[model samples]
Target chain A: MTGASPADTAVQGTVAQPEWQQLDRRSIWVAPVQPLAGLLLAGLVAITFRGWDRFGVIEPAIGAAVAIGVFALSAWHWRTTRYRITPTHVEMTSGMLVRKHRSVARDRLRSVDLTSDVVHRLAGLSVVAIGTGRQGGESDDELKLDSVTTEEAERLRRLLLDRGSRAPAVAVADPGGPAEPAPLARFEASWVKLAPLSIMGLVALAVLAGGAAQLARSVGGDEIWRSGPVRGAWDWVVATPILTVVIGGLVGLLVLNAVLSTVLYVLFYGGYTLVRADDGTLRISYGLLTQRSVSIEERRIRGVRMDEPLMLQLGRGARLRVVAAGLGTKDGEGKEKKDSDMLLPTAPAAVAHRVTADVLGTPTSPVGAPMRRHPVAALRILLLQGVSLALVPAAVLLMLALVGLVPHWIWQVLLLLVVPAVVGAWLEYRNLGHARVGEFLVAQGGPAGRHTVAVRTDGIIAWQFRRTVFQRRPRVLTAIAAVAAGKGTQTIKYALQDDVLPVARDCVPGLLDPFLEPDHP
Target chain B: MRLRPPNNPVHPRATTWWRLQDAGFYLVVLVVAAGALFWVSTAWLVGVVAVIVVVGAVDIVVTPPIRYRKHRWEVTDQAVYVRTGFFVEDWRVAPLSRVQTVDTKRGPLQQWLGLSTVTITTASTAGELKIKGLERGFAAELVEQLTAATEATPGDAT
Candidate 1:
């Protein structure tokens, strides 16, 4: 395994190309464990649902045969998959019958992500996925190495991103170099206190509730209600005062949500760290069970986004996302690498700002700078939109009541929702602001989750201003700054035409000059 | 403070193409509604059909010219500017330096009329600007010009 083995047959005749290497040998055993476990879980579920007595010897025989087949296939996959990083391109060739070859130019490489699931971690292996800056390509756009030694993964991350240093192939420096990169931020146990403030817990709860409802329906909902413990609980609930029951339920849900959120946060970002590596790349590594590391070229980063959800903002916590081009990619499972762009998880707002500044190489984070507010008419427009949106459900309920299908009280109760609608509109109006500070253009908006994005003016590729029919009267418009980075477009929503035009012009300079009419004459 | 309208309007034959498209679409809608009318006996649907007929007639007769006026495009040395839509108007501008690709598309009607739509794309997702209803020869020329301009620019455009 250590020598320039016969597997290098693909590159044997080539002169200057690097030798093609196979996946880690241990992955043949380790990778199979995950799928094998899934098979076992499926078998157990079948036995549990269809009774053990129904599980005949032939079933286990077939299962064992399938397991062996899966292991053999995994080993075969390890044999065929080979990758090499040449000076100009990082190339991989895999598959048996189909024969697939993928090559991404080193210059076009945007991100190198190293991910190790629990099984891979146990075997000390990592999967390296290299993403290019190509737009709108599917999973084929990424070059993936399924399993490699952790040291190899680290070396690849360094060599691929250190294009400026030009240390190609095996001349890579050791990790213990003299100038160790300082971390911009690291996970703190105390930050767990901010986890509950994130909407993750509620989102988890909603998913659980949905699953529970689906399970109940499948198993006959009446059977669950008719059960002894559930029956007693329902009786007690009926006997208790409405206020007490409601309060107790609310308390229970809150406690459950807090516990769930904290556990998820820890599992997802246990040893999180944001570091600017000596290779001129920003490396963010986190996750407890499935360790993941994302390395992005610092030069490719266009901006930073500080996402402060209403709950998180109330708790003085924020999540930061780097606005970079090649940070977006899908893993082998076609799951959009969810946290690939995350610079920091929910943490203290002060820490988020500090990390933002450090990452952007600025003294003060532009996201925290004071911004120009939208005109008062913007608020009026939002209020009208919100009230009209709130009225839709109330109107539906009123129509139902009129038809004698629903009680009249339902519609009346729904009308009270107008209060929250108005409040939300007010919050959205307050968040509508944009400003230009130094070389960055900052825009913030959203009602429940406010995002303040600070994009470098030079990164903006194009400018678009749209006016809806309703907004024409108010003389307000949504100015969208189209960039080739994160989310593609940053919007300054509902700003007065007069306010947005100058900002747009100043941000891109000559780009908008041909279109804009002089305000002077 | 204000934006001057783009310089060039689409080819005159675009009005005929748009009218044909509207006719095809309203024909489908009319057929579907007439089919649904068989299963249900609702008088309001008759009124709905009347409204649809009026709207479709107005769209075929009047909208083509209005859309032709609104859907204007211009290509300068620096950038490409496009304005489209009637009720909900849109203005898109993409600089030549950031332009990624230029493509020409011709639908069946456009092919019949010898007209084409030129789409200019930048690296940004929202940066695709289309100039509809240009002479096929002119569209090809525009694509060639845009390709040359984009190639001359240095940087990765991002």
Candidate 2:
């Protein structure tokens, strides 16, 4: 039975079998939430059946049947789940009716991680997942052992990752171990300052407002959320002086969004701590009730990103994320990248850069490389693009004006928008900088806010240059550097036509030389 | 473009493909224009039909020969360069290392003409680049060469 035909999981029977570890018995306490929901659904269905509405016993019986069935299934699943970590492989077998045996080779293991929620933590249990980093079949390549003790999760990560990779001699979180220098860093309560400044707060507030509005609409009582204050605000604005109205609306939105963001930031990143562990690994642990820990091997980390939205930038704050493969992009993996991959919630830009440098094992942050500006034509292109974008709304306004559908005064507002549009274009052009760092190419883009992404030049697998009819006129083209990790495409947009050849060559030297060489034409 | 050194050209029968496509295009347009004419005996419809027919004929007769002259495909040591698109010429370079897969396809008409299309899929989401109208033998060789080159360049970047 051990001599499996599946070659990837092959093991020599001569070796002592690894001890099989069952998940904490407390795991039974954390039954799947689906059954309760299913019970409710069953009750609803029971009601829909003719005459069942008049029979309370029938409804309760149906609810009890579904509820009991769900609980029984969860209990069985928890009871049968078993896993083991060996020197060369991590194996898992689980399932009530249909058994699933998954084994990943030590050499193939790319990630070892854990997660928990309030209920799981209360029961002293955590979910452990092992990954091969291969992409296919909805997380088939990953093996999950749900609801293990926190201590067991740490030991499994160390024993599996360290022995499997010839990783630096392992240490069990001992501060004084010669194997690991005192953590490169630990959580600082002050880092929470970054949380409130993060744009996630604003985004969260917007999402919350949208969700509330949608909920209101679905419940058929949107008047309270939609029109009550918003319409009142418009009326108030009409009554107030023009300057006061504009200022009041702007200030109110800004303040409310900021406060909401702060609340969300604290809730998610409250006890976040990042520590350098044995063998060039980073241990990231965070959360309040649902504490989780993620171990990132340096070898798997292809790049680090420092994101600074307008608000974060204004506060000199930046959030850090690792641009690595298999962390979140793939299915049945890290469910929320925002919560999982974030290295820093929010920190002073300088401190964030310093941490970036430390994790990257370099004195200078790759993202810190000074960006080289795009040509002046790029600025012109940006302005023209912005103007064209505004033209659509302007055309609609004109059409509406013809029908007396909109105030002609609004035309003046559209006219006024020309200034900001141009300014925005100018800002975008300024941010559209590209630079070649050591072994990495940096591409920065965006307007008002900027995203400067740097990927190892060696990691880039493909290059693309697209020139439209409009771009041809301006002698500019968009060049994309395709990497295997992160969002995949890091674009150098609106590059001067003349600059295209040199940039392409620099990104991957000699690849485009034959095509770029000028011929008789 | 007129003076550019000629690179590898696809099969001569590619012109048949282009002419057939052009005919199909005009056929659709003709039905729509004729249907409009049936509704109103406008004299302008005749003029429009004449213009369309003339343009379609000229294009059918003229474009494929010139386009076959411009379209080129080559495999470099570093990358696969495909130059196509007559008016707005697109010259793409897919590095051998970045090639994820190489495939060849043939339509019914192409099969009758022994023509095949070679496609090179790369990691970049720029959409795969296709070299069409290759002689079947040449297309197969191209796929083999691309696959070998891709394997030869271990861990090549996109």
Candidate 3:
């Protein structure tokens, strides 16, 4: 019923009707793991709350029923799922009852991703997803294949992304270049040294601590507090000098955070590689256990953002992410989404610039170019804002102290925080800069770590200038370059109107001309 | 250096429309505050009601004309320019080549005032540029002009 038209067949060349392919048989084994794990976790929670001695056959019987149901559904899904790649479109038909058919035009294909979690990896299967750059309803836009052989996944990625310009054609297209070039970037083992600088370890630690706390609560909170080692530690903590104990705890936490972050870094980016294939596609593949590879047409990349956390900046490290249309923001999309645009994981700043330069096809990275600093009035405004923010807590604490509800030193300490706030605002002002280099508009700003984004001037669709009443006195405004990719807006926050107007005019010639008035002498 | 305001002003009825909208919002607030009088002291209720009424009156009276003056829009062959907001003024410009869609919307309030809002959208996630409260006929013309201009240009709008 869902057959191709004559035009589709013509576009496909000799193949009139391509044979529909089945998912790898191993997917049935892989699919049940998720549902079974969920059930198992529920059972474990129940057992923990009820006590192990109360464990009965009822739970096992329900677990068995769920396991069988999930297994049968998985087998049915495997049996019914079928997909085919014609010259014009990649099509998939799947469903036990609803019979859903999804197809994406070949020309509109924006990305092809292959991700394998631990279960799929163990089963030697990969989930392939093809994106066509449609906005809204992320799941509906992509054609997802639950599980396929790794080899088949790679073949599909190559075939879809590198259709017109294969390796030989690319060599012919650029006679000066080699047939196969080295990868643009690769993981360095020493990168783990910089892990402690990243907050990833602290984030993991927080998650682990939260989970452990929840689990302990479920298992009975009193039992843990009454336990021998915990009780002994509690007694020790009570007996120790307060300052000494606080310092020791901080030191231990730092050490633990360092170790955890390092392990997480290794697990997340163990074999990271960013390669621009001969056919002009950027391929990024990484991960230790649950491997993921994403291939995006290089032309789709509108810009790149180099992220430098305060600690990472101190270590002279940065992370690079591609600003592209198809890959949605990590948080904007729900969790379990494998759309990652990380061109280079946390690495040396120099390495990040080099990779960025290579990827953007510029002689030198635009982000490193000399930037025009924001007006000093911007610094003054930031200082005022930061000081005012700090004053709020100090004032509240002072009122509490006066009422004898809190210690006096607490408010004093809170007041002292103004110094750091001032310093932070100053750093942010120092980082406030924008530059137009070649065809890229680069903007860098942040309170702690700087984020320097270099957006392709042509990618910018519009310009927006915002000025609050407070900024009118300084003749300062925030200029946002609205592009279709990445976060979709690159902002030069708090710049003099004079500075940004000309920059905006030059960034995309004539777009802002209609709105700007003549400059006064 | 400052941006010259866009060339066209919205319909005069826009002020009345805005006043009605603000009045409706303040009415709801007044009702809520009056309800809360039963739960709290009369002094607190009076204070809350006074603040709300004062703000609402200011918003309804002082803001409408200022907003009407500030809100302007212009469309050239090359681009669409719009200026909006009173306290926090904003100027936006989108090239015709990058405009993906042009639409006109009219709420019940706007319909009563014979006003329509024309929205110009680009592929950018910065969102659409809306020139609110234009005469309905003029709004339609603006949408038609924008649609034609965007259609004539030949890019993916990305």
What's the candidate order when arranged by decreasing lDDT?
1, 3, 2
Against the unseen true structure, what C-alpha lDDT does each candidate score?
0.85, 0.70, 0.84
TM-score, candidate 2, first chain = 0.78
For candidate 3, the chain B TM-score comes to 0.94
Q: Using DockQ as the measure, what is the rank order of every candidate, best first?
A: 3, 1, 2
B90 in model 2: Cα distance from truth in Å? 4.7
Give the count of colliding residue pairs in each prediction. Answer: 0, 7, 0
Q: Per-residue alpha-carbon lDDT of model 2 for B1-158, expressed as tens digits?
A: 11122267889999898788789899999889989989986898989998999999999999989878867877777777676765555566677777888999998888988999898976544536788899999899888988888888765233
Q: How good is the docking of model 1, as DockQ? A: 0.71
lDDT of 2 by residue, A1-521 (tens): 12221222224455566556677776765756534754464445334432353665765776678767776777788778777765566788888889988787776666677888777777777788776655323442567777777767766676566643332344234433475455555556666665555666568777876865655544345334354566787677688898987888788777776777667666666777778875556777777766777877667676777777776787788778876655544435534334556677677888878888888777798889887777787887788889888777777787899899998877767876778888889878878878777777788887777777777777776766666556666677677777666666678887775665576687777776656645344
Give one digit per residue, the lDDT tens place, for model 1 in A1-521: 33232123224346456678788999888888987886676566456545678667998999899989988988989999988777667788999678889888888998999999999998899988888886554542677888899988886777677665463322545575676677889999999999877667778889877866776665457756676777899899999999999999999888888888999999999999888876678889999999999999998999999999888878899999999887664654456767778899999999998998898888998999999999998899899989999999999999999999999999999998899999999999989999998899999998867899999999999888788777777778888899988878999988999889888988877877888886566
Mind sharing the TM-score for model 1?
0.91
Model 3 Cα lDDT, one tens digit per residue, A1-521? 13333234334365557678888888998978976886688677667556778767876887798798889999999999999878777888999999988788887888888999899888788998787776534332677788898877776776677566343442244422475567888899888789888888888888878977887776677766776778899999999999999999999988988888888889988999888786778989899987988888888999999999888988999999999886654322344453467788889999999999999999999998999999999998999999999889989989999989999998888888899889999999989999999999999998878999999999889999998888898899899999888777999999989988998999888778767787573
Q: Itemize residue pairs with steric clashes in candidate 1.
A: none
Residues B27-73, candidate 1: write the lDDT tens digits. Answer: 99998888878888599988888888999998899999998989998
